[model samples]
Target: MQQAPRPRFGIMTAPMQVGYHDVLRVWREADAIREIEHAWLFDHLMPIGGDPGGPAYEGWTMLSALAAQTQRLRVGLLVTSNRFRPPAMLAKIAATVDVVSGGRLDFGIGAGSRPSHPLARREYEAHGLPFHDAAHAVGSLAEACTVIRRLWTETEPFDFDGKYVQLTGAFCNPKPVQRPYPPILIGGRSASVLRVAAEHADVWNIPGGDLDDVVSRSALLDRYCAEIGRDPASITRSIHLPVSYDQPGVTRDAIAEAIDAGFQHLVLGLAAPYPAGVARWVTDEFIAPSTWN
Candidate 1:
């Protein structure tokens, strides 16, 4: 069999003010698209870091803008919460975005966590929903996967019955541009999350943690995949690395170590001070170097 393509490198945009739209435009123009295989944004109502009053853009809307502006780069949320909307609706929205992006979409999913916005929390409370524990959250995620899969693959309307979500005759029109739906990426580091990724996800995106944590968790994920009778190679491993390289030549070593340990993608977080400056550093130091090659 032919060897699989080398894992691609990509960047995740920090949530910022709409005025920073021009920053994205500039990055794309500066050959960032050629350097990065994928460009991701977070799905959040407000900044997850720094000043709470800082401006942040809506993820899906930003993705839509990216789809319209870029031709070569894949675009999507780094991980969208399953609790934000019903699965059927989210699936349709994903399909629409995929079509708009000419089929370059990575559907990243995650369980809901503590809301960063008061309005979001209020909405959740108003719906009479309980704040989910990890187990409940994973179960809800499984249900979401079921609904999304059924909407994309089943010809007839389907019903989903789950503890957290229930759908009667949910249907999606104009099936996704990618056959059998776009790639599903699950984001987390817990054992339950690893099991879910082994069972459902095409990609596994783990957050940046201690180096030992990443290695041990990645090994656990491989074990889970084997136990589930799935090839470990089928699941792509990716990581989100923080952007805090105050010194030269550190980021490259980190990337090398991660790649050696079977990580295929690296999403650099630009949430620190001087995001635009960080963007330039990533493009010049990481992308322009031989790390990806």
Candidate 2:
């Protein structure tokens, strides 16, 4: 039997409670490391973990800057909330980043934050955006995916009459550097979202911690893909595992488990106040040990 491909590792520096220079410093460092395959930022208008009043840099704006600053690693928001921007506008912004990075953009997106997370939910109202019900959010996301893909691939200007979104004479000029378009990585665990991923995503990502829960979620995604007559193995399985600065051993174990669970794409999330050489430290502690054949 053919051996499974080795898991590829990346880093996510959440742009919360951190300064612009600090984040730029980390991304500059990670850019030189061959072991780090991609870099990511989370999409949030406010601090979700640190002090509520602390600084939170907008994701897409910062991402464009980072794309200009880095050369190798693929870059994107860990998962952009569809509710944050209209689909056509977002498609244009993403295409610009893809061009800036010379085609290194991974379009990670989702059906916005869940209602259960009060911290994440508050951002919508604060930003003068509507916070709709979960069913509406999921339905809108599915349609957003369709509209965005068409905006990227369709040559001529077209109109979209989606239930949650509508566009007239929508067209993207100076298309993305990537042929067809940048890879779509949909991040979510809901059954409805998984069904959307089954139809649209090139990659499917979920947060790690609950291995049993994620394993079952991945299985559900496979079933959804099957229901649509798409190959279950076609969608790459990605997991976001948080890094432990003090306990590298614990992180190593999580990496080992996630790899065993068949997660081919691993994004190691780094917490704020990142230590010196954190990227290299991650490779030394978690990636190298877990990659042993």
Candidate 3:
């Protein structure tokens, strides 16, 4: 049997549920947890499926604040939308945050807004920005990802040739504090998005999927990695999903299944408001007996 990878926990919380004060408290609590390696927040202008008009803090802005406040945890968005910023600029933002955190930052990215989701369409309408089709958005994401990677590592500036964005003498500086650069995570389900992950991600997040589903998708990613002539093991496997932590056995089983499938980073969508001290609750009920620690 293969030795299981070391596990790292992350709380991928939707912080807008409560006020900003509670949001800060939740992060502090998460930071205090043992083995809690990352602190992630949803990168959305508003909630997707739920209330579209609810209060939501912008992802990158919240990240800058979190970086200064937390000492040990790596701060990042669960996945930032490519449409939000040009690739080079996004890289700069990430690098700056990494510096603020003293090298504690994980850069998670994804193709832009969803076309099918009603709220997404509404957001574009309200904000006066064009909501391009999914194909266009993914293409843009790929291009931006390329620019970000090149900017982070290169000392000299270079031109960016892309359909959506063009950069002459592109450069992002104070290169991320993490050597070689911060871990880049690409998250999504579509093939185009997966291909982008293969091309430029250090970590690929498999969000909202079942165990069997995760296996086949990971196999697909392996195929993508192979197609690119890149080793499949180069990318770290990660996931975040809603689970009924109320049923301790079920929660433990689900986590075990994910670990067996080679997911080293586990970010749970534990219901916000963290209901009765989530950290202590899980540490006692699941984390201890689950063999992750």
Candidate 4:
């Protein structure tokens, strides 16, 4: 019997670094949206592995921009960190973005990690919070998810009391276009993260991990889902692959490997050095193929 067609193929926009603006332009011009299922950008306050003074675009703002510029590609934060913004506000912003894109928004989030910039520390310090503790981070992440779900699904003002956040009579207008809400994609490799994905996330993104890693982690996720009485198949499994277009058609092999490992989605992370080149390759090599059929 023929298997159901999998909704595969996604690309992750490198966060604003030294050359991201140029890359963004290339991607926009290439019109890669015609081929890819989704376009994602990382949510971070500062650039990773770059000069501290280098550029870094806000994830949500970039997503909104992509929503306006691209016609067919679904755009979202690869995963925004929950510690950076209140869940209620995040839900409103996601709803607004969803409405703007005519329902092409995928809401992905995670617990915030340490930033490189000293000023970036203000995000946690200003909140009178501590950094570098995984347990606290997971707790914040769980609470944030609860608040976001409540804000999206609850019609009346909702109240949430949690360890990290407390909300009273929180209401957001213009619910997301996706039935109950936009699909939620959560990221992290920890046990807490897996449990959260099983409980709430519609999709779980494994960043830069191998097939064996995914298989092991997936088992844990499935166990958590079973414990919660939720079907593991209900959650889409995705992986972030470091990809380079320099070798023509390199992604095809990677995609095949990912699919073999039961990954339903691929988040391709373009290689550096002329970042725009990756977008061009995707347009000419992937998008032009009429693969979706």
Against the true structure, candidate 2 reaches a TM-score of 0.99
Off by over 4 Å in 2: none
What tens-digit string does per-residue lDDT give for candidate 2 at 159-270? 8887999899999987998988999999999999999999999999999989999999999999999998999999999999999898878888888898889999999999
What value does the lDDT take at residue 50 in candidate 4? Answer: 53
- For residues 2-102, write the lDDT of model 3, one tens digit per residue: 76667777777776655666667777877888666787887777667555667778888888897788888888888888877767888998899999999
Worst 10 residues of 2 by lDDT: 284-293
Error of 4 at 200 (Å): 0.3
Q: Note the Cα lDDT for every prediction shown.
A: 0.76, 0.94, 0.80, 0.76
Cα RMSDs, all models? 3.3, 0.7, 1.9, 3.3
Q: State the number of backbone clashes in model 4.
A: 0
Model 1 TM-score on a 0 to 1 scale = 0.87
Model 1: CA > 4 A from native: 1-5, 17-20, 30-32, 114-130, 272-281, 291-293
Clashes of each: 0, 0, 0, 0
Q: After superposition, how far is residue 42 of candidate 3 from its true place, in Å?
A: 1.1
Per-residue lDDT of candidate 1, residues 1-293 (tens digit)? 97545657777766664455654664475334466778788876665556556677777877877787778777778899787777888999998899888898999998866545564455356556566666778898988887898898889987777897888888899888889889999998888878888899999998865778998998998999999799988988898876556754666767767777778777766543444555556777876665436
- Cα displacement (angstroms), candidate 2, residue 285, comes to 0.9
The TM-score of candidate 3 is 0.93
For this target, which candidate reaches the highest TM-score against the unseen true structure?
2
